[model samples]
Target: MTRLAMMLSAVALLSGCAGRGGDLPLQPASALGRERATPVDATYQLGVGDQIALAVYGEPDLTRTYAINPNGTIEVPLAGTIKAQGMTIDAVSALIRDRLADGYLRNPSVTGSIVTYRPFYILGEVNKPGQYPYQTGMTLEGAVALAGGYTYRAQKNHVFIRPETGGGETKVEATPEMAVRPGDTIRFAERFF
Candidate 1:
């Protein structure tokens, strides 16, 4: 009886540690699919660590690549400091145009494009987990491949991701097509069996 009780207790303790800890809110995989399907409708917002290339028509001095500062702002040659975080590329371009028109030039035409996006991180149960450069249209499965795939004990059905946009980690089903955003931290949980 003593030996059986000990075995049962050990089994219970092991079962409790099988899953990833913490109460992460669950987001259905379909929701992620829907978000990716309509990428044109939702524009990508700029954030810190992103590099942007801006060009001002007929003004070579004001055209250059600028990195978004930690405070979510970027300093342009004639535009001074402008907030780029949470703003779209077109919005930033318009702001620069307006800023230049304020005192610098007449109807200054400005265009902005993303030079480089922030990196994404991966951890837990993957063969090689670390930060990797983000590419446009990257998916969860693609990220897993970059992380050297999953370990034998990894739970392949779902994973947890904390978005860079500032929100609680959400549990999403691990699918080949699930979109991955820049600066996201993805975690793969261990499997019990």
Candidate 2:
């Protein structure tokens, strides 16, 4: 009876341990995704490879698109070259208006918008991960899908993104609604089950 009791107790202990500790807790990097805060949308910063469209009121000749030069400037007719990198659309419009007002046109009304954004990068644990063209209202989930979806062992809920505007990488829980910006690098880590 004592031997049977001992065997039953051993089996109970083993089963309890198995139920309690199936996998080791994820390390700091992996654990980071769970405690996500609401992500704020930062203003879009212009960079090289971005295509911008600008138009001036009643100036058909000046209404066109131009790719940002490697030096962060764009050529404008009669206005010469104007710096555009790191400036918002409104700021660019103001700059153009000021430039055109000089010996060109009085109170030149200008409007500018981004035609194309720089490509985003994705690597690690995703199938066919690489650079992909960025679209408006992109999210982490969307980026993963563009990269051909997650791999078999991808941590679908955990992701890290590095912004091109200069901040370091951030780890956040993957959500379909979180907005992604151009020139961001996304990483879908592997999961250990």
Candidate 3:
């Protein structure tokens, strides 16, 4: 079979295994799953501490790239200061366009993209412990893979994730195909008698 076919078969088999463990409630399927999805607002949102690039056609003097400040704002020429945090890059561009069109420029077109994603944390029993950069579509297995693939003492079954959500830690049973997030603390406990 081709690699793609082999992968699909493997995924089918693994999903079957994920279903058998029933200890944890299955989260509704996320867009992060095996299939790629298109969103109505597809651009990534700029958060506090995000680095962004901005461009203006025929107005290079007013264009610049910078990291969003702690207050989630950026100051630009003519536009002064604008809040950019919690907004998608495209939305930021549109906001700039609106300001420029209000007598700053004729039909200004603005564009922004995330140059860096803030780092998050992962810890416990993983081969490598500490902070890792945030990446979309990250999962438990994928995070473990990045951590040098579980230490010999790493428990294959009980994995814990403490996310940055600021609520509480989540303990989960690990399936090889399970997903994880950056800024999440993943702990593998030892099996006991």
Q: Among these predicted structures, which one has the highest lDDT?
A: 1
Clashing pairs in 2: none
lDDT of 3 by residue, 1-193 (tens): 6999999999997776553233444233242242232221345556666677899988989778878888989998888798987688888888889988998789887887767665656666777887776666666666777777777776677665565445654555566655554345666764432
Would you give me the overall lDDT of model 3? 0.67
Kindly give the stretch of ten consecutive residues in candidate 1 with the minimal lDDT sum: 33-42
Per-model TM against the reference:
0.86, 0.74, 0.65
Candidate 1 residues 49-145, lDDT tens each?
8899999999998899999999999998877899999999999999999999998999999998998998999999999999998888888888999
Can you tell me which runs of candidate 3 are displaced by over 4 Å? 1-44, 162-166, 181-193
lDDT of 2 by residue, 39-75 (tens): 3233566888889899998999999998998999999
Candidate 1 at residue 128, lDDT? 98
lDDT of each: 0.85, 0.77, 0.67
**Highest-scoring model, TM-score:** 1
Candidate 1 Cα errors over 4 Å, as ranges: 1-26, 33-42
Query: Could you tell me the TM-score of candidate 3?
Result: 0.65
